[model samples]
Target: MKFVRTNKDRLVLISVAGEIAPARMRSPYSVTTEGKVKVIPVLGGITYNVRVGDSAYGWEGDHVEPGVSVMARKKEEEIPFMTLPCIGNEVIVMSGDAKGSRGVVTGKHGGVNHVIVHFDDEVLEKLMVGDKVLIKAWGQGMKLLDHPDVKVMNIDPDLFEKIGIVEKDGKLHVPVVAKVPAHLMGSGIGASSSASTDYDIMALDPREVGVEDLRLGDIVAIMDHDNSYGVGKYRKGMISIGIVVHSACVSAGHGPGVVVIMTGEESVLVPEVVERSNISDYLR
Candidate 1:
């Protein structure tokens, strides 16, 4: 594998204003169940006690947590904050009580353009709105030396090493927290590319393999899935690897959100289940 680093002086520093509270759907329309429209917390700020690997707490729309979501200024600036940082990149607080504290970029929540970061419990307590953060942005054009068939997406080279991905018998063996069947995948599929957006886990059953066991930074495998450039479709022998970016949602076809990191056909990829396969564990 090869990674080319960008000029350090040109790296971008983004400033976040605050955490976004739960939003209510303006249209009085209902999809699955309804007392009110699908109301749930979307993005921004510290998620206090929630830890990666914890159940996204499906079905409880009002209280679920979206761990450590941060955003830059609205409009154009939000683009850089969302696109520059890759999974496993380091983030340092520049201005706040948590100034000088460091954290790892875990995932990005699409639509809201929020980047999720993981920090120590102590750091979380110290973080506040309007904190300035600098991202060392280096994971844009990475390549596998031996395998050209496998496509890489939104993953830093250093972080990719920590993911426990190994080469064996001409295929990449990836360690994941859980394996999700393609049938359970919902919203965001076929909507965006693996490079910038994420697909949702339907959360049809709370007891599903990756459903209850999933955490904010866990890496999971989606079987029979193909996301070459974000057009999600089913193809036999294909697998998609992704990072869980948001908490589970109560609405149908919505649950823990996962952004694509790596994908390949059967000839190039294979997924292995490993307990506690989360970003926090890898970084530690």
Candidate 2:
């Protein structure tokens, strides 16, 4: 698309470490929206069944993190681990049986503050809790020179190039799986930044909108939601594109969370719904 770069040489690289977190549940039972209490596998560990291109719905689990969920070893290092690694960054296993294995940063989740990584099923089988992984974080300060109005964040440069963003009439046309209404946005509303944690899409009725068939890593468009200048807020005529990082939730305020990759004026940030909008299509 020949999009211009603001300052290609100035983008700094960050390195951080975190371990595979063990699967955890707040209590023995979690309340479902249907007024039933049950125990289900939630966040953390290596998920064998679910993956990047798999459907986010129809799981017995609640707020499940696909693939491997990682977090810093200590509380002090949590901020850097969560904030530095942007979506699509490279991750290398540094400890345990999976050492030397490679993966890609899928996205991050809020509240629990975990980063999700996608690896082959073979690698997932070898991964275990307390295993360490190093991340090569390099996608924080990118901006589109030709379409400056369209803000970009939390995405690696290589993946950005593969996003299929086309420029015409001075506007950026981004590919998305579906267009999500502003009202459907439920959790993580007033966050200070979109670089670290993610916001959720409330799916009270999954079939009510087109998100029923959404999959992890699918890029979707959020209407009237602005992430320009850090805060995730609602502004008239604004739109944001994000990746579904986690599974659909049974919790009232949570659902498949989306980490923003790009945002701008609706007029300039056009969404082109296509058959393929998942990041897995861009990579292996």
Candidate 3:
């Protein structure tokens, strides 16, 4: 809990199911120097979905190279405060008797901090586990103040009470969920880490993100930010967004819906007739 790195928006980008890299590279045995010194072959380390306490992914082992150090505790800012804004996407029920009861986020398994809310199925049959859920985070990256190209990322402002999309006369309705088209989307924008090494969307299919058309409160949109749709350096014209945290698996090009959240350049905002809200429901 003492990871003081505040920019407000306390970090929440869960993703882990498969695909990892760096598995071999053994080279160590040199001792001949008189004026030159060079040795390189580390090959491992740097798989941070963040895991240390609960275990299952963030233990800090398995890999981590770039200057190799460990004790970590350096953070001068960035923790403005974020307990649940979009702990996966908007939540409620602050105390007992399902205090407020309301949920959405369905995944945050980054090394076991736990955060997978859904509710319904009879309130998840009644709810259990730890039971606390009280998030609001606050209008995640809110935009529209002047249309910047319309870009919202990892939202969780209580998700406009469940989910609502609005665009008016231009087209782009909402409700129903699952769209994953725009050309499959896959490349690498800042490199998301479910575990490590992942970024492929070449022509997906699977009935266009299958699962009867993706559900569990779907919310996806990854229509090219750049890299043509796969190397992720994207930034031109910005518009790469995502949210469908789960549902869709067969592994061809893998598919369990997940992007938790993301935005583009300056944060993205360009409105002329775009008004859909669900950025984690006004940040709990």
Per-residue CA lDDT of model 1 for 115-212, tens digit only, reads 77777889878877667777666565566657766777677667777767777666677888788989888878876556777778876565855467
Residue 58, model 3, lDDT: 18
Candidate 2 residue lDDT tens string, 2-43 = 553544457788788898989988887878888889889987
- RMSD per candidate (Å) reads 4.4, 1.5, 18.2
What ranges in model 3 sit over 4 Å off?
Answer: 1-115, 118-133, 144-147, 153-181, 185-238, 250-254, 258-284
Arranged by TM-score, best first: 2, 1, 3
Best model number under TM-score: 2
Q: What is the per-residue lDDT of model 3 for residues 31-107, given as tens digits with 9 covering 90 to 100?
A: 22233322433222222232111211112222112111111111221122212234344455555555566654443
- Ranking the candidates on lDDT from highest down gives 2, 1, 3
The residue pairs in collision within model 2 are none
> Could you tell me how far off, in angstroms, the CA of residue 226 lies in candidate 3 after the best superposition?
12
Give all TM-scores, in the order shown: 0.82, 0.96, 0.27
Q: List candidate 2 segments past 4 Å from native.
A: 1-8
On a 0 to 1 TM-score scale, where does candidate 3 land against the true structure? 0.27
Best candidate, lDDT = 2
Q: Tell me the whole-model lDDT of each prediction, alpha carbons only.
A: 0.69, 0.86, 0.35
- TM-score, candidate 1, is 0.82
